[model samples]
Target: MRVLVVEDDQFHASYLQDTLAEALPEVTEIFHASDGAEGEEEARQGGIEAVVMDLQMDRRNGIEAARTIWAERPQSRILFWSNYADEAYLRGIARIVPEDSAYGYVLKTASRDRLRLALRAVLVEGQIMVDREIHRLQKQGAAPRNRLDDSEFGVLLDLALGLPDKLIAERRGMSLRTVQNRLLSLYDKLGVTVDPEDEAVSLNKRVRALNRALVTRTINVETLEAAQRDLDAWLGGRG
Candidate 1:
């Protein structure tokens, strides 16, 4: 089997190549790319049956590279080995993968045997494999009702961008009351408590929720960057 390993760290890339050679004797050839942009370019060259990718990279992230790679070749399997189980990565992965596609998300800390199993599951068996730790994190992150549904998140995003409720409602196609309620739900989910004693100097729960999300990584720089790009495109279209 021909496989591509997309990792910025040279040492890790080499290690992965060696491991693949040992674990899967059928993996006759392995290609390497140092970063996501290079990975995308290599993938575009074709003939790659599967890919082992690192989630975070300097220029273009693994998600972006995977999106383009899958767009070009939907049947290509991918295995992501990363140090983090960040919600942003999970959400990004969820958005790009084709329905019923074979993919894996395993952490770097996983045992070599586990990694081997995941690699085989994705590349050979054509199955989905998610590390136990990552699965736990995904469930924990999703368990909260107020973890902000799409509409609530939309309100929070608009609030983070310093938009008023009226503007947020207009932008999201929600009523002003609905927007306010969603913002309240978001604040609750984010643990942004209102201080009744300081009614005269009330804290801005919206700002608090945004800050909490940023610090906890329920939201991150990438989310804001994507939102900004979307806003810019919307504004451009309006013009």
Candidate 2:
């Protein structure tokens, strides 16, 4: 099987290549791309049956690159190898993956045997493999009682970025009232909803909600950083 490894770190890339060569005899040929943009291009050129994608990369992130690759080739198997099991990364992957495609999410800290197992499961066996920690976060995030839909998550990102309701509405192309409503929904899901008659009313619901989210690990520094990048891009386009 021909495989492509997309990683920004040359050392890690070389190590992965060597490991695959030594361990997985099925991986006869391995290609390397240093960043997500190059990775997407390489995958698009065809002949790569599987990809070992790093979640974070310069120019483009793994989620964006994988989305494009899957758009062109829905059957392509991808095993996400990353140091982080951030909810943002998981959500991004969950949002774009083709329903019938096989995929895997294995952490960088995984044992060599586990990595080999994940690669075989995704590439050869056409099975899904998610790291245990990542799977726990996935289940927690998808729980019905506290689940945040896509729109709600978008607003939450804007809130975490300290964007006011008016600015959020402007950025999201919604009315101020709609933005406020979404905030209320976000607060509800985060379990930070405040009652007007209660002493908690003195606290800012937005701040409270963000704090709760951070404490629960629903959103982390990486998620906020990704949001900031998207916001910067949006602002750049406007200018």
Candidate 3:
């Protein structure tokens, strides 16, 4: 397999190159690029098995580079390594790159074992493994990410499917209180809480707020569409 490494820090980039060389010695070709711009050029070249990229860089940010890479080579698996995982950044990646069997994201501080597993999964299984810590932070809504519990997820699914929350509750054996609590939590997380007296009302508000955020670029269409597409593709296959 051929791999491309894109990082500004020479030492750090070299370390990754060396690690891959030692462990996956059979990885025939390894390419090195200094910054995202060079990395973008390198990535757009011939058939590359995978790319391990740094999220932030001096020349061109990894995200932009990744975007360009995605547009150029949709099938080339990508793994991002960053000290910090930006929510907006994550969202952007989540959109264009299909999950499971091709993409992954990890912290720069990730352990060697974790990195290896991530690369292996993308190369072997073509699945995306989001860093668990990144998942947790996004779940808490500390980042500009949407958080949803099982009940709230159900409500959101209904909304996405064009059903009212009240009707959803009736169809799903969920109590009105339970549904209301879910919406209240959603409203609080979304930072658009009003009276919070009605769960259906709250869901309505949450949907509008989410829509506005998504349309305004505060949330991002690519990310959500990618997520929705994945679910549809996966569930469609299952059904």
Give the alpha carbon lDDT tens digit for every residue of 1-239 in model 2: 88999999999899889878877788878999988889988987758889999988878878878888888889999999898767677777776789989998998888888887888888889998898866775676557767788888889989999888888998999999998899888788888865778864488878898898787767766567667877998989989
Candidate with maximal lDDT: 2
Total clashing pairs for each candidate: 0, 0, 5
Best candidate per TM-score, number?
Answer: 1
Whole-model lDDT values for every prediction: 0.82, 0.84, 0.68
lDDT of 2 at 176: 92
Error of 3 at 128 (Å): 1.5
Q: What are the per-residue Cα lDDT tens digits for candidate 3 across 1-239? A: 88999998988888889778866755788898888889888877747768888877766767667777877777778888877655655655754564333778888788888877776776546787788977675555555455544456445544554556676676557987877777666666556655657656544575675664444333443334434544566557757
TM-score of each: 0.85, 0.72, 0.59
Instruction: Determine which window of 10 residues in candidate 1 has minimal summed lDDT.
Output: 221-230
Clashing pairs in 1: none
Which residues of candidate 3, in runs, are more than 4 Å off? 98-101, 140-239
Error of 2 at 103 (Å): 0.8
Residue 51 lDDT in candidate 2: 94
